[model samples]
Target chain A: MGRLRPGHLVEAGFWLGLCLFLYVYSFEFDKNIEIYKFGASGWPRAIILLMAIAAIGQLIHHYVKGDETSSQIISAAVDDGSEEAAHAAHHETVKWYLSTFALLAIPFIYMRVPEWIAGTSEPGDAGLHTARLIVAAILIAVVVYFIRHHRVRVMLMLPLFFAALLEDFGFYALAPFFIIGVMYLFGERRPRPMVLIMALIFGFMLTMFVKILYVGLPVGNIEPFYSIGSWVVTVLQ
Target chain B: MDAFNNFLQGSITLFSDPINILIFLGGVIGGMLFGAIPGVSMLTLAAILLPFTAHLSAEQGIMLFSVMYCTGVYGGAITAILFNIPGAPENAPTAFDGYPMTKNGQAGKAVGAAVMCSALGGVVSTIIMMAATAPIADWAISAFGPPEIFALVFFGLAVAASVGAKTFWKGWLSILIGLMIAVVGLDPVGGIERYDFDMPYLLAGIHFIPTILGFFAVSEIFVQAEKKVRGSYKAPKLSVDFPSLSELFAHKFAVIRSIVIGFFCGILPGIGATLAAFMGYNEAVRWSKTPEEFGKGKLEGVISSETANNAATGAAMIPLLALGLPGGALTAMMVGVFQMHDMQPGPLVFLTSADLVWVVFAAMFYANCSILLIGFLETKTIINLLRIPFQFLAPLILLLATVGAYAVRGLTIDIVVMFLAGVVGFFLRRSGYSIAGIVLGLILGKIGEQTFAQAMQMLHFEWSGFFDRPIALGLLIAGFLTLCGSIYGAFFKKAKTPQTPDPDSA
Candidate 1:
């Protein structure tokens, strides 16, 4: 919360360690199949090697040249706000990270649940297989944990869970409407008109990619829900 | 003699096309708009407009793209002088003196000098490009065997390494990182993955669209995230007056010198106008009787830098249009545009499409004239763009960065890439490393890789192949001399600062 420290050696070490791990893992490539001359792992290996070397060079610079000036710059960055003010400001920031993490966990949790009350037992394709879907969900959650701020995390989940659910309930186009409602209105505080403008923009994008571009989307068990999209696609064809 | 006569015929053919003039004017104006705007990039314009050129003949498309390249560079000076913020990365030097000058109530004069100087610079570069390109292309087409290419790649990498702070190890290390990132995709020759990590995207390695947006646009957002961007710059109330005769004559030597230096720098693949501007600015500062006036609002500093940067634009096209070696991003875009219209860019390009080459040369000259006109007429309007409040601007900037990042791959994956790159950039800055060199190296990494690999293969993996290529050998010598120049730059820059207690200790 005070500020991030500029410890070149620490960063250099971490990246170097990651590079080594990636290289070591690359050794497990199945050579039984002749995909290409160098195999799948060659490019990754080269990247890892170069990254490791770069990290070492960074460490060397730290050791020999010693850039204390940059360290002071980092310290000065946070000092503008007194330490107390910074401490107080940090909590709200952390909340966004927490929310984003929780939002990401939803699909994974649903996957681990053994049985659905009523729905298709099997997903449509290989990518949508129940096991793969769960893995994908978990991957997203983990990635989101590292990536997004926590405050909007829960709001992000509102899309797939609620909107996608409503689409199955026969409100096909309307299901996406709820999504805009939740993310734009509920997530951020703006006057209703501004929120409406944002919602319309989102709607336009939905219409473009889904209806105009004819992108395939899963609408759950809801029949007659995507009639508008289907009609548009039919017309274009 | 035959090629020369054919070239003359081609020039006549180019001049005969009325549509070519319109294309030239449109490209220059559009390029100026793109370069002045924060989110709009030269590559973006080139890529988007390429499809439209599919209907035209190859020569017309090449001419249009060249205009875009030339004018996009000229436009950066507009925002740089008016706004404290630099619209394009290359305009950083312009912001230093130009912004300070604007605050000194010479906004009109600064814009005038920048526009005029840039025009002069570009015109000089265009002439040089036209004169030098044909012979150079002939030489390159014959000489660039694999060994020469290998040597050239090494030279480019070394020049990239020369740019980062004094530590050679750090610079090399950065190049190593860039090369590693470049190595992730499938091998072109061997047809195998090196570091695919089993991800489908990894198979393509990293595309320029996503990577450029990530590193340039997104990282910029994160770095400036905590700070306010928009500064209070009232448009100065005045007329567009040309520099007085004596004032023009006083800076004649610097202007001519910068154009020459910038042209040479531009002829080299990968260095581009950014370095040309910096070189010009440095020399101007060093020679200035009022070196102290530079960052405080000296018109000479602005004139030298703006002139050289725009000049480098036309010069960069010479290597690309004639020799099939693009010296910068804008010219690289030109190569794509040319290919789209079925105009192959190479040594044979001039021979097969002489009219197209002449059209591009003609376009470069006209684009300078067009920018000059726009600069003269719309001087106040352009300066007033600086008056917009930073708070309102910053959020819009973030949105644009996000939208642009998303547009790159049409993948959410790129959005994630943008965020990651920003954080990485932030941390790199925190670590006292020069991101400038690393970013530049990343951009050039693939060029070096493909060139090196091809060159090596042609040599049958012989080490001496690099030395055997005459042009490659010459470039190596040039690269070595540049290192010496950088050292001298550092030494002199330090020596001039008398206020520092211990210059030696520093």
Candidate 2:
């Protein structure tokens, strides 16, 4: 038996805590009916109990055998041995935490700020549109700065941002920029092929999903973009 | 005879529509393209297209998936042989002998064997699937009650959890997490919410489509993006030569053995094509006269692996159709498709949607045959798709995933759920947990819970009543034994000494 790592203990403890919380929460469910002895909470409670047991068993097993097997497997799956070593060298750096926080927070800000601004103003107010544009510009500048330095983090944050803005900005108004932005982030420098690819993808989505399938893809809620989205759909139909 | 008649009638109806023929051919081509790419799995394409299935007829939708499943299993062999990259996990075994052959300048012969054996295995398995599915469903309809069904689900989850993880405990924990996810909405029996926390979206239950997309597609993009940052991909030179009839005839017995292994393995709930491929290769090596030649460019190795994986594609559908138990993630997504069409899989589905079921059978059979022609003609063209960088495709895939998630219920919340699931899946994969086990648990948990409640009610809430039913008792015992075996292997087995890390290995 070897010594367990702190990371292993934390992972095991997370599962144990989660299972315990859910098990306690299951008590809030309605009581058992006449025909059913255990009712709605029974199945979840049973599952949670098993999960807690597994978590405890895992903690003990790691304590006895160490996490070498798991570490090797994870390292192998993620990268070459040298790359894993490199990752380990900087695993505890503040840069990693900051990058992850930025990746998560950018999308939250992108999705929430507009709603916050809209909540304070009337729907058709000109000031609301201007505020949104200013916020969007600042966010885009921040993303561009990160893209120059932390390409992988920006790659991850791009999808989250896309999801956050997709419904409000609409598919047509937002998709081409997304395609170009992603291609550019990926180091596709040539503008011609990027434009061609963007057009092809945009056209395909419009034809297959909107024209043929009649999927109610969102048009933007705001002016100009909203009219543009509807106009394209109307033309396509 | 009735099954054969149903199959014939299905062929007639399917061929009657030019549009169906077009969709079938398109699915085959699309499946191969997706599967041949290193980063893209057929599951990504399937998840992206799931929303569109709602607009098509049930036959078209199911047939599209059926053919894709058939061709996708074979398409991965192209990359495995030529580039040393297994397009999907199931194709990983092929690269052992396949890449060695490529290095030896015998890539043509390796590919030829893979194509022939894959088609043969798939066709044979489809025939078996068609013959066996109706009878199995009939037997299940006759024999299985709520208790038996619950026990079977339990067995399935246990076996699912036992395979495909760094340890049995991690696998089991993943399954428990998935079951917890499934328990979020209103309870099936009493309609009492378990974990909804008073949100209307949560009350309807988390839709599985977004979860599937997030776990399989978005997480895959994240994985690939990290790889892209670490390394560069190069295109492989393509060469293919079909084997002579005489050459193929020499390996007929190996092919037969693999087909048998693959089909049977595919039928087992939660065991899928990846296991079948490895098992086939293992059995081939065991039976070979010069077993030492297997990993060193033996054609039998390629034949066994490709054959078994493709064979499992059809057989994997049997459990999904007969008992509504999906053997893997792709089939689990198929369950979502079935629900999207307002149909439930299982015995009653055969009674209600016989035509659709038969069409799927015919489509799979035809899809396998089409692979023979298409694999021969378009091997080079398909390999060309690898030239497109993963960076370019990642955003497009994310876009599709976003739309696919939202289009399911026209809910923005589903998109959020999908992204969250993707992040969770990425971390889960990093930690060496089985995403497939989690998925299987999510799909089966509701059914298991419903049946458990009904079974308890029928038995007057006596826990011991399950033991009175022989089939239920047998299944429960099997599940218990599987767990015990996993525990024993985890603890009682001697641990291997840690070795120095190999710097060159990727």
Candidate 3:
């Protein structure tokens, strides 16, 4: 049998980790001794066990039958062994990691930052606190690795950046800047078209959403922008 | 006569209101524009527009989304004909003969044929849906209990096998993952919170709209950003060369055949418009005396694909509107819309929300007319629509996806969730797992659980009672057969045979 592919290992590890979490978490729910049927944790525990079995089945199938489903799809999608294809594949793998790390970091920070800022970490929830810290540290390490390798692009960070800054800066303040950042990352050389396009699109959005439809959006927490949003709402009304 | 009256009343209600007319037109034109753009699908547009629809009355909301759904299919065909890039995968078959026709300087002719046939197909299917919906709904209401419903959902889940993934196991795994995600929130019977991990956001479970945005729109942005997007294309100057009445009549047989095939294909779970189009094309090729002309700029090819693709749209709605089992991803998202409006999408909805049902029917008919007019008039301009680079487009999509997710409940955490879902969706697709299967399971999971729980209660927790209801027993057998067949097909039948990528199978 051939050695297992990296994908196989990664998938198995993910399932195993998830299974462990599920098994541990299930312990928190007290079984109702009166009833014979499964309780709250029963369904989830059953599912997790089935998933682990499936993962192991997958691993065994890969080794025994020499499964090549993932690699075949990759080769099919890429379709060529040329240097450009290889480069593109490499870049795709990079983007995938970038996405994974950013997904983990942005949500963790967004949820934890407010509490962390308030110094709400307590010994009572020390384990949860430790878990959060480990996730944050791993995210930071991923970011460091990307920077060191120069694989990180501005566009890759745009979503995470927007998620981080959106609440404080508000839609009015941040949307145009996000558009500009995206335009720059997409390799736009001309400033004139970018500005013109941004204005047209954002202008239409503000009028339709805020002025006409009266859809609520975040107003900037800081001074003049808050006033601007209030004035716009007032004027539109 | 009563059904006809209701249908007429629905049309009048929509037409009488100036705002409804405006929204209908906007939905059609906008749906087309979104579908015509590569990497921007009708699903993306509908999901983005879904929150906005909440402000409208239920009838108006139904009309807007229905119009969008109908026109979006046609929109994808426009780019498929012009640039050889399908705006949606379902339209991919159109590019086979469409690009050749474009190369032959019949771009206008190709566009006209595609637009006309798409309208023809959609109109026919809408008529079918209109005629079929009430009877089917009546039957469903009488036939199905909780056990039968569970069996039906199980069948729906089993349809994941037909999703044309690289391997069936991968697709099933994706569904399992989706089911796992679905069960993350409060448990049904006792209301005990499951996997919220102490976060308030998990209380209601993962919101459907944000999940849809993350899976379809945001993941597309990532995929588009990774590829090198060229901003320029060589194209002939366009004009509408709409087929003469006689010319259309000449291909009536092909169009009719395609309509029938597409409608039936749409009714089947998991096999969607993409398959319909290819089936239509293949059938046309098989019947044609001049089969060699098919890939070499045949108008019949365009008609067959465009007709079947659009026809499938209305046909797919039958199962969704009647059974509450979405036939494909697009309708799966529509289920979320129904949930958004606090309407459950089963047979009883026809009784409770009769006006909304007929409004959808009327909106589809009007949307097809709008496609006919706009598609003809904008043939020249529509070709220019392809000039927008993925660079500019990707950012706009990301922004829209973010805002769409946030707008659902005006929550920033939803935005984060959207991005997280997007990342997961991206990796899942890259790894050869079918997103459709995952989406099906996600949308159906809660319904499955609820029905199963109710069934257990009804049976007093006797597992054997599942097989006691004759209709439920039959459906359960069917579901089992489908699952076993899929497993056999995925492992034994397909494992040894390397298959090429077929757009129709996609």
lDDT of 3 by residue, B231-321 (tens): 3345544556777879889999999999999999888766668678878887998999998677777889889989998899898888888
Instruction: Return whichever of 1 and 3 wins on TM-score.
Output: 3
The 10 consecutive residues of candidate 3 chain A with the worst lDDT sum are A72-81
Tens digit per residue, CA lDDT, model 2, B305-406: 899998898899988899888888788878878888888789888998999999899999999998889888877677676778765787688888888998
- The candidate that wins on TM-score is 2
> What lDDT score is found at residue B241 in candidate 3?
74
Model 1 interface RMSD over true interface Cα atoms: 9.1
- Give DockQ for candidates 1 onward, in order: 0.14, 0.40, 0.26
lDDT of 3 by residue, A75-130 (tens): 12111112232245474464656564654565457456645644665523545444
lDDT of 1 at B226: 25
Candidate achieving higher TM-score, 1 or 2: 2
CA deviation > 4 Å runs, candidate 3: A2-4, A30-36, A49-89, A92-153, A220-237, B229-240, B243-248, B289-296, B494-506
Output DockQ, candidate 2. Answer: 0.40
RMSD of 2: 3.3
Cα-based RMSD of the predictions, in order? 7.8, 3.3, 5.3
